[model samples]
Target: MTEFNDKQIDILQAAEKLFAEDGYDGTSIRTIAKEASVNIAMISYYFGSKEKLLEALIIHRTSGMKIQLENIFKEDLLPIEKVERLIDLYISRINKNKCMYQILHFELSTKKRIMDMNAFKDVKYENLQAFTKIIKEGQELGHFRKDVNITLIPPTIMGTLVHFQMNKPFFEPVLGIKTEEEYENYIKNELTAHIKQTIKALLVHEN
Candidate 1:
């Protein structure tokens, strides 16, 4: 498990918040230091540089996901059930780690090369490969469509969740959402159900 002192965690949390608000390129070491309530040298000492800090943040956010997915795979359940569990797991994690998810989506959409760098590429590939195995196994078991593109499924799932998350301000009035708790409930329940149904349809829909 990746471990961080309380101060390191504070710095990371501050960075995540700043990255969400300011964009990665716009946020600087000085800003992070101030937000984190640490001196500039402390960040440099703990994380080396801004790039390495970003990498550490990614690692911290994603380190648990692969293991969780692997354990879900080991469960004695049907392929569709496993897929449903995976969906729930993802939605739960993403909601809890919204900042990390936002940062990840931002980097992927605008700074593709950053995701491919040595820092994040392995974890990304490992996650993709793990999900690929799940889908392939489902196909082999005659549970999922053989023609489904496993490569696209992860992005599709993530994009759907991120869209709903990032558009809450625009959607709230339109969708009749009134309060933060209600909006969170909508995501935790209704939106999650929507994603589950959507994924199920995609996996089983006739081509």
Candidate 2:
């Protein structure tokens, strides 16, 4: 069995949990080391610094998700099926990295502190190209309406799926829902239905 030293595993797990709860500026290397039960200096020895560790965590999570999406969209599927699969992938990835997603999203929504170029230094081009390819295929196959702008669709679709995670607590207060499981079911039904109908309105033709 592949084994990680307790200190190493502890650092990673501690960083992930802390970063999830407290965003980049709010989390500290000392706090992480303390949480991990390791020397504060050991964080630098292991990961160089707080920022590098955060960067590595993002890269690790995104790369795994990128590979999965690339494989999922490889086959030329039907229009509705493709939409369903895309939402399914987003929902699945969000569930897998709920904490990391929260941290990354905080950075995204903030007006003043979005990620700088250095933050995404190791990002894969294939991740972006895959989404572009999917849209291009839909256009080529005449599944997506010719009038609909391909460039605009993907980002809108991403925003729609992200809404569940981004505005979660607000949803409970506004809609009077309880429990994460109930909230997830609400998102599944609501977002899937919204995506299906919105895509139909945008791209599908029915007489």
Candidate 3:
């Protein structure tokens, strides 16, 4: 992972917020500069161009998760335990970086391409590779089903979280979630448990 100075971190955060609010095409380098309280030249100096800035921001936000996923395999735990830890790690990261995740979701859902898709997909693939390693370990241990479709695991986890995020307003009212804190707690606890349980069922061998 790349180590960013305070200025670079500020600029990336500013870009993240702007991208989430205004969409990538609607935001400009000048807007990010103002948001970060830095000159336009600073962004150019650090990231070169808008496309590179977006790529850097995506990498900055996601690289930690990928690293953590890789580190999970080194921990002293059963394969199933490692998988559950991955579920928790993902939920916590997504919850903390809501703006960045929202930016990614918006870019993916829209027809107009604003950011570099390949960069985004590359980060995702790295994370998936780490995740697949755990699943394969479990399969080798006779803990997970051999026939499980490993490719679908990421989507199963990400798609459910995306659906919950997109439909929060509907879900909040239906679930009687009356406050922001309540909704966040529900996501971190209830939603995380649900996803862990779902994945466990999908991956675990039948009794």
Candidate 4:
């Protein structure tokens, strides 16, 4: 993953916050400039336009995750252990970048037809292929059931994590949590444990 300079990082952070607060259509170059505390020309100079800025943010955040998952999949560990580690990686990444995920969830849900989702789709496809390779290796090694669908596993894992994040208003109160930090901790530990257990069961269960 390429390291972003402090100024670029500042712009991406500001864009993420604004995109979360206002839909992409509602956010503007001027707003981002103001929030980032940089002039409008700087944003244009860093990223050509609002659409491109969104793409850059998504790429920057997801690149590290892709590398981490690829490394985990390549680790000389048991298939089952690798699966557990993959779950941990997903939860940790999503929890750390809640804002980015929020933007993703919102964009797909509300602006699917209009927004340029090509970059996002490409990244998602690449990650899914990497994950499928891991699952296939496990099946070949007799660690996972042959009947398990590779395609469904990624959505199963991601959906569960994204659900907890997007439904915070509903879940935080249900879980009886009051602060964001507490909720993050619960997701990182308790929720992560549950997801790992569920995935392991699905992978190893007998027909």
Candidate 5:
């Protein structure tokens, strides 16, 4: 991941917010500059183009997760504990970066070419590999079942969280959420616990 200065971070964040709300085609470089309180030239100087800006934002948001997942492998915890930590890490990251995920879902759904698709896919693949490494270690250690579908685990975690976020308006009422804090707590607690339990069930072999 490329290092970004304060101004660059500001521009990327502005782009993320606009891209989530207005769609990539709807958002312009000028709009991002205005939102960031910087000039168009600054955005151009920092990112080179709108497409590059989107690329930078995508990498900026996702690169950290891959690094964190790799670091989890170094921890002295049990395999299942590490898996639980991975779940918590993902839930926490998605909850915090809802807008970025929203932009990704929309862009990928529409099959847009606004950003570098290969770069996006590379990040995703790397993250999946990191996750698969943990699962393989668990299997080798006789903690997790050998039959676990490595490919499905990433989507299972990501899809569930994305679904909850994208359909929040509907789910909030159904779940009896009334305030912002309450909703946040529900995600941090109930939602995280649910995902952990679900994944553990899939991986843990019954005696």
Candidate 6:
């Protein structure tokens, strides 16, 4: 695997930051060229276009996760460990750049026709497969309830963690949290712990 040259990395990083801050429609190749300190023709030469560059960023970020989750699901780990680690990686990935999450969330609802689902379909399906497969295996091993809807639970877990920030502010005042950083890490850790506890309760046989 060859390395990304300084110029290539700069364009990539600039694309992620600008695309996140400005949204897809508002971002342009010239702006990225300016932000990256590269000529517009150079970006076109390396990455084709701004749209392709954005797709590359999402793919790059999620690819590591796809590989990690695949490894975890293949191991002989316990059910609760599987669930906990899944949530852990998911949150840690988000924590790396919370702003990117906002960019992605917006893209899904507003730019679907242009962005289409294919840009991220694999990542979504890969995660759903990992969680549902784990749930099924756990059920067979008497860790999870056989009657539980594994598919529903997996997506529900995703929806909850992803949207927790959106709901955090409304509930934060009643709970009296301080700065945004405090609220973010608090939710990240709490969400992981809560998911662990919930899965623990779902276990039919405790070891």
Q: Pick the candidate with the highest lDDT.
A: 5
TM-score of 6: 0.81
lDDT of each: 0.84, 0.69, 0.87, 0.83, 0.88, 0.73
- Which lDDT tens digits does candidate 3 get at residues 1-207? 357999999999999989888888899999999999999999999999987887788788887677899899889999989989998888888777778888777666775655666766788898889999999999998899999999898789877987898888899989999999999899889998999999999998777
Ranking by TM-score: 5, 3, 4, 1, 6, 2
lDDT of 5 by residue, 63-156 (tens): 7678899999889999999999999898888888899988877777877574567777888899899999999999999999999999999789
Compared with the true structure, the alpha-carbon lDDT of candidate 6 equals: 0.73
lDDT of 2 by residue, 104-174 (tens): 76766674453443535434455556655666667788776667665565556667767767787787878
For model 1, the stretches where C-alpha displacement exceeds 4 angstroms are 1-3, 112-116, 205-207
Candidate 4 matches the true fold with a TM-score of: 0.88
By TM-score, is 1 or 6 better? 1
The TM-score of predicted model 2 comes to: 0.77
Ten-residue region with minimum lDDT total, candidate 4: 110-119
**Model 3, TM vs. native:** 0.91
Clashing pairs in 1: none
TM-score of each: 0.87, 0.77, 0.91, 0.88, 0.93, 0.81
**The best candidate in terms of TM-score:** 5
Error of 4 at 36 (Å): 1.8
Task: Give the Cα error of residue 148 in candidate 3, in Å.
Answer: 1.0
Q: What is the Cα-based lDDT of residue 143 in candidate 6? A: 71
